[model samples]
Target: MLIRNPDISMSKANTVPFGIWPRLRRETCLDSGSSLGYASLVRNDCEKQRQIPVQLSKLSEKTTLLALVLGATLICGLPLLLLFKTGLTGNGGLDLGPLMEAVQSRSVRSALWHSVESSFLSALAATALGTLLALLIGLTDIRAKGLLVFLILLPMMIPPHVTAIAWIQALGPGSPVLRWLGLAPELGSTHPLYSREGLVLLLTLQHSPLVFLLVRAALRSFPRELSDAARVSGSGSLLMLRRITLPLLAPSLLAGFALAFVAALGNFGINALIGIPARYTTLPVLVWRRLASFGPDVLPNVAVISVILAVVALAAILLQGVLQRHLRTSLIGLPQDPLAIALGGKRPLVEATLWLFVAFVLLLPTASLLATSLVRTYGLPLSAETLTLENFTEVLWRQSVTLRAFANSTLVAGVAALVIAVISLFLAYFLAHRKPAHRTWASLALTQSEVAFAVPGLVMSIAFILAFIRPLPLLNISLYGTLWIILIAYVSVFLAVGLKPVAAAFLQMDGSLEDAARVAGAGFYRRMTRIFTPLAAPAAASGAILVFLTAYNEVTVSALLWSTGNETIGTTIFNYEDGGYTTLAAAMSVVVVAATILIMLTMNALARRVPAGTIPWKD
Candidate 1:
């Protein structure tokens, strides 16, 4: 329950700008603490004599939250209904025969099994690496920690296929790294990168940051007191970690693992580039090959697979929600304790090992991309002699599909990001005012968002085709192969990704200001625009950046949804990779990475503008 300080006055003297509110949470437990604090603040009127009942405030919040939930449900549910209606009307409504036969196919089963196996291995590996990296960077006193953190997260900016290409180039025969290691020609045609193991390695390196970021965030609230208590009980650091820290961090680990797993499962670019050539057929590759090879014959099977994958992903997300709920219930009541486990004799060695591990896992792939971008050689043994700006220059001058793809990606992704930001801000605002009604609504919204994450890119694209193709004939709108379809796909894919951060930010905010605004006769829009939006700038900006980056770097959905005329960075890179244009792909990847970094920097700046402690809206 939120504590309300009745003694405090809501007057001109106390009314500050939007930034001062969040700081107050750090100071006053009376007015800013607990769910009850919010209702009290809302009820605290100089003109009113009596206190507001807790049940009434909760009921009001619940009602408001339900309305928001209903709105989101309509937005998400209608499109899906339309999609299915179109799919059924065009063909035979629901055809199971083809799908069933496809599922029974040996090749289909192999592909499914391989996809699951690769995704699981890669996700687990990424989780381990990400957790260790987060601990090293966030918990330990590492040198150049900030720079190292940036380096570690750099691979995430590069698309999986691009990373695969860069690695293949670097580690392949006569590549710079291979030559440096004195294992040039003897490496033969056997590349470690063009196999299932290679795909797993690439995915793990590329996706580990998802784990690292979430884990790092979780680590922030970890009190050292638990460790102190454990030590006082005569437990060593290792034992204390085993008994205490791990348990506390379990929810975070689960959240990260779930996300990484979904990412791996849905990944298409990495599988296309690395897994396909080695005859290692994953579900995504199989889906793409089927559609490209067999057309709509594999439609139902694709749908079944897509739906199944989405269900699995939804289950993971649901599990995360359950785990997070458990964590909050179990851990939120615990007091903050910042006690540290002393490293004793092995601190330096442990630190060094962690640093080296991070460097190798995070730095190497990015460095390879950057290194290859500056070079003209596609074969290997890249040297200063082979280094040039030709690749970058070509991107500027070439009137190829790559350039169009870049433009398309930027235009579509930019719009989607902006739209997502606005929607998430409102959703988060509503979520902030919610009580127990929050979980169901948030869960539903999250489930819709998880849809795109579960299905392979090709399968989702196929869904788009089956869903949209017949609609145009009926409506005479001709939406198929248009940018709208692509945009829609992006929104469906990224909505959840954008929502998570914004929801997290909202949860941190004190709800009293919103209540006060309501009491002051402010309508919902006025309260949201006037009070909440300004304060939530930081989180909104972060969400927008994440959405923008994901959209910009997206390969899977774009590859499937994009028509010949409609190109995206992913499609461009995929084409280049397909044609064995390795250096060009590296150059394109470099461009994407640069763009992501610029956007992130912009987000950071936006976050700093309404600095906390300066504005009342910070509440």
Candidate 2:
């Protein structure tokens, strides 16, 4: 009744029999060159089975894909294009005056320089640190690899502003955690993390997880033949690593660097909270100050500076993509596990050091945040008497803005997640199963999504402001300062995050299932609902969860878009700290961190349902 294929498990075969494939009287055979060689599904012997005509039952995939592309362009393209037009041109010709003045201004120049210097240095640090972690956890026999990876990725999930806040409390003069450790800096002395060095340190900590993810993905996807050949030629571990593996990892390293650089360059929370006190400024903070101080009157001038920031960010990402394309080497295998060499006696020491680093990076700061949250006041030392839960209670129950922010964040993020999930499901299907002529359209949509995500959230917000500050043409309704703008920006900016896993899941699927359903006279919607949805449901669910977690905690996307009653949790906490309500900020941040962890754990429970590597933290 069945043709056995060693490459594909019986469970997978069971998934493909959605229709009457088994009813065919023909013999089954396997194709060796099939994707992943899922031989059981490659039954070319069923040629007669596929000859059935179902023309009228076929769906309009082209029209659907075209509509998706147009929608993607509206979401991702028009805003930035409008922002550029507003900045680079006026009612007449080229508006070189404002652009030139922005560049020539002393403060603007200094901010630009600071941004470049800090991002470069931090990216360098992140690359090194993340590479080491990836190599250790990915390729070596480090103990508790699952634990290590989770810890490594944990910091990335925590927002940059929260990291800044935690570290400030961790290292500050009045820090309860530092005081408890007897390592507190003396009161009245300038806080150490309030300088350029401090900004770089915090940024490196914040963005290193991104590098870790990219580098580890590269390591996992690398071909093993290189390592095997080196070993057969009598190369030791270090020699092979230096000469073979590291050289092959150059593309990943450069990619990690670029991502880290762009993340740090566009960072707002650290630049604001730390840079302001130290008299240092960066582009994002400068944009915020100018816009916040002058409001819509200075929107055009701010647009000029935003254009410069956006250009730099885009250039770095584009350069990396070009270089990675040139440098990338295809693996002989579609997917395989990386080698896990034994560490011998050094395992204990490596494990200890790794855990120590995790403690400093994640645990220490989290502990500091908790301590800060428990305090009755900002500078008060923690004690049995001074300890209080009033801050949490106040934010969770008493404060109207806090309550409203919670509601708004939940509403917007949930709606965005749902919307993105549906769009990604269809887009992924088209991208993975399209005709040859339609490949470009699918890639075009993906590219636009990538371009939107590559730029800083700060810049995206400015673009949205320029694009939507005025009322809609026909509707005569303004989206500016509304929750809808934040939702739209979230959908546009985070489409990439939601699309990746769904696309990956689609790529792994056998197109033959859809073909069989069609041959059975099943319509497009029927095949999709009955066949593809069940298989990809787990991945789509995970993608939606990721989008929700990302958008829910974001401050930058809504930084400019949020208004009186439309505050998000991130903005609320930021405002609290900015307005000298540190205890409430810390309390709210703790709650956010807890909520993020809970959501992440929920996603982890879906790990088995999705493909490997879909859940980033899960091994």
Candidate 3:
């Protein structure tokens, strides 16, 4: 029988003695000899006190994480939705007429299909070529591997539009290729470059290096032991390659293909600079042209296309993410001895073929551009008299848009890089040190940042205009033509790029060190300043430089957004060419290329100074 009192309850029939929770239940109660229960009361009090605060802390952490995730999602996703939604709204309120017009338009259909075909073909070709190049450089002992690798990578450093400009100088409409074909003087009169094939070629050349870099890294990490074992088991090289290497490299190859596809699909710079002039139309150009010619009425259609492009990119990224996770989990952790296979008697032929390919793909266009820059005119007047520094002089003295453009580029890109780098470090730290209760939602918040990269630069710029223009009056700041808008756009566009490297660095770092500092009475910002920042400086620097270059060479976003006198080097170069300043644009390209190379070299040096294991993997 159990009895309840006003102050306490007691059970007399089946009472169990406690020792230590479960252990106590099976043990004897020494206090039974005494008519007292003081020990059990004290034990109960201790346990309850210990758990209450912990439970409360966990609840708070979870609340914080949920709030962060929701906030970040709205910040990153709302602009895109708003940019598109604005088209649905007018003075008459919500309207579906514009949406229907876009859906029913024949030109939009053609343009959409054209963009798809161009991007697919370009990405496929670049991936194939890039994969082959990676094999030659990474798997085999090719001569001049170091030098050739850099040269092959050079195309990636140059902006696609700048590369297009160089190609136009060398191959488009005129010059030696046409002269040899007996049609030099009448270049555009006979041969036109503004065609689908020309756009594909330009995109392929520009994007191939990205594929090469990804595939090369994948090749380096491949488990050659599997291949060797297959060989010893009487499997041929061809069989092993087809069964093993291709499948293993699939993730890397897919990632490269997806990135290239996304770039080609959304790229306005190349399409505008080369394709549009060739009288060819793609989705980006069509969107811009429609926007410019037809005003906001054409926006919903552009938004639809932008959303479609983003969805495709997102799908590809999701696939890549799944494959990467699988690969990590499936790692066998087997140790293998390094093995190098000789080319045997066919070494020279293999070497020659690789060199020939490198020369044609990497060196030829650049060489032609350099040659054109040196010559007085665009022909082969081999005499010393024909060669002059006049073009270079004119570029320097005219104090053309190039000078102002360079200053603007430096200011915008430099500031954007610094801001992004600092913000990323804190974000990474918060994410890495999140409590278990907060981990899930914090991760979700960070994931949305990746989606921004998939959006086309032009689409993002248009969204920026729609979102920012009206809010300026309410926000108490004029951002329309000021450097602030460009700065914000630049950071937003590249924040993911900066965050990924820094976050990876943070994750590799042991949390105990930060915990120790915290326990030792160090505050959040101080601990970060004293510990994590110094430790992650290398990755931070690398990410900042990468962001800067990305912003500096960005034409797609800057094109629609640039205000008068706020032009970047990229936009100005395009403007110069549009205004018939070919020689000056070429000279400016040289300057931008030189500056970019210098920055890259410096970053590589800084990266080398950091200790191994700091970067997670060799990037």
Best by TM-score: 2
Which digits, one per residue and each the tens of the lDDT, describe model 2 over residues 97-169? 8899889999999999999999999999999999999999888988788777877887888877888899998
Q: Candidates 2 and 3: which is better by TM-score?
A: 2
TM-score order of candidates, best first? 2, 3, 1
Clashes of each: 24, 0, 3
What TM value does model 2 have? 0.88
Better of 1 and 3 by TM-score: 3
Estimate the lDDT of model 1: 0.69
Which regions of candidate 3 deviate over 4 angstroms?
1-75, 88-97, 176-189, 294-329, 334-339, 375-383, 434-437, 471-475, 604-619
TM-score for candidate 3, residues paired by index:
0.81
lDDT string, candidate 1, 1-619, tens digits: 2443444555424444446554454333334444433344444351232223344545565666666566455445544554344334336556555546656888877887887788889889999989987776665554566556666776786677777776777667747665666765565578767777888888898889889887776776776666667778999756876788778888888888888887888888888888877899877787677667656545654555555455555676677788778775255435453343455676788777867776666556566777777777766556778879899888757747767887888899889888887878877765554555566676676666555545455656766676666556556786678888898778766777677667777788887887787666566667667878888776776666667777888888877777888888888888877987777878887787777677655544554575542211111
Q: lDDT by residue for model 3 over 125-196, one digit each (tens)?
A: 999989988876676655777667767777787887778777776665445444545645553453345688
Every candidate's lDDT:
0.69, 0.85, 0.71
Worst 10 residues of 3 by lDDT: 23-32
Instruction: Name the lDDT of candidate 2.
Output: 0.85
Which runs of model 2 end up more than 4 angstroms from their true locations?
A: 1-59, 606-614
